[model samples]
Target: MMKRVLVFVFTSWAVLHVRAQSFSEVTNLLDSPTVGVFAVGTSIIDVNSDGLLDLYRFQGTFLQQPDGSFLESSGDIGFKNEDGSTAEGSTVFGAIFGDYDNDGYVDAFFEDLTAGSRLFRNRGDGSFYQANQETGIEIFSALQGSVWADFDNDGLLDLFVGGDGDPSGLFLNNGDDTFENASANVGYSPFRNVYGVAAADFDNDGDIDIYLSSCSQFAAASRNMLFRNDGQAGFTDIAPSLGLDDDRGGWAVVWADVNNDGWLDLFVANQPVSGAGIESRPGFNRMYINDGAGGFTDMAP
Candidate 1:
């Protein structure tokens, strides 16, 4: 009986290993050369209004087919420059899809490190056109993450872009396919090296609040900020009083009701300082639990 049990276990393990080996590699189907590099952003959306979802990578865009394969379509989809050239060496970071003009078609937004940001408006006829200049939504800075939300309870969607050295821009929708820069007027002054941004109503109020993650290596004090909406088309910084003022290197931020107690909480991702090698100590990730009132406690110990 012992011999039979051992044989049975060995046979089952061998069959599982063989099955795993049967799955072959199909990555060679992509036309681009595999350079073993980090990709900044990837978004899956139907670019041509087709039933199939398409892939948008920082390197280029790919369209999905019925055969479960993707074909590069960045040039065909007008993601290149007006001179019919791609951003060869530029670093593209974030990509998001939203109906900015309420045209029933999802438009695309791509954030670049140095080449500025681009907005691609989707035409219903299965094509996209760069409308950043026309829409008055251009930002000439090192942009990182971007988010779209109706902060002022407006019917149209507004845009918030996080920057590296420049102050983050908040573009309020004018309902006419154009935007007005309202960053200074909305209490986003004294900007640092902003990285990621998240927008949600933490106080259960009708207005949306803003949370920005900042990072730098200048030995300058940097802390993540939270701006509360005043419901009068303005915002107030309430992060320092809420115990969120820390000098850690912040990267990304996310807000959600983690405990499901009808209040929203914040999660921040941190990293070591720039140029800090493996010998440097890493920053700890934090989770700030929100009380039913307006206070927050760092539960990351």
Candidate 2:
């Protein structure tokens, strides 16, 4: 099924060659204004609601562009500020697109390493406006990954931020174009340097919970942490009993029911950041198939 999805996605791109371009070969479309390192785009979205997924990219430095090849304004592109500026020092990592405000328009969120994160409210047109201060999930210095879920069962979306620093956060949607931080009280503080976070209602509890990939000072080959939402205030750490915190160099993660047993399984990609050959190819992506028991076993091979 996953193979078919990948083939269909690539074949559809080949069919709509003009509108859909793969991120692996997008150097020509980029407008090089400043020094930057362009990695392959890891996420895609239609920020303008034009039915075409715009590339959400991370260039080591910033750049400029002329706007062609089905590319829009590179909306909300980051700019380097002077020494005393608010955004003076930071590198943007990843971007996710969603209709966060229930306004029927897809918006954008960005994760930066050195500075604070950004939430761009879609203006219903082609452009976007930054509402970081307005949304209240702003941070000073941390690497972040943004994920969305209807956390409180409020029919509105909330955000979870996985950080490279301790005490990763959760931002609840206030239903009024604003957000509230609820992580510290929810057992998400003292996070021990989290990396990637993915949310799902794994226990059929109707309340969204979280699973995180953590890399900290204590965690050399980091652990995959899990948080269970208890419907009232805070969450409980449930990774140890479920056998998900094995600490095997876990980095990026995604969860799905591979066997369709009504239980969501997990898949984690690992790249050793502390030991030898950290920048090599063919890193391992381990699959954890749910056995309907309380524990999980690695099924990658």
Best by lDDT: 1
- Write down the lDDT of every candidate, Cα atoms only: 0.78, 0.66
Clashes of 2: 1
Model 2 alpha-carbon drift over 4 Å, by segment: 1-37, 59-69, 75-89, 273-285
TM-score of 1: 0.81
Candidate 2 lDDT trough over 10 residues, lowest sum: 79-88
The deviation in Å at residue 104 for candidate 1 is 1.6
Tens digits of per-residue lDDT for model 1, 17-106 = 897775678766666655775566788888777788887778687888788788887777777665766642267888888888887777
Deviation in angstroms for 272 in model 2? 2.4
Task: Estimate TM-scores for all models.
Answer: 0.81, 0.75
Error of 2 at 86 (Å): 13
**Looking at model 1, which ten-residue stretch has the lowest summed lDDT?**
273-282
- Per-residue lDDT tens digits for candidate 2, residues 33-89, read 324544522465655666655655553222232343433244233322333332322
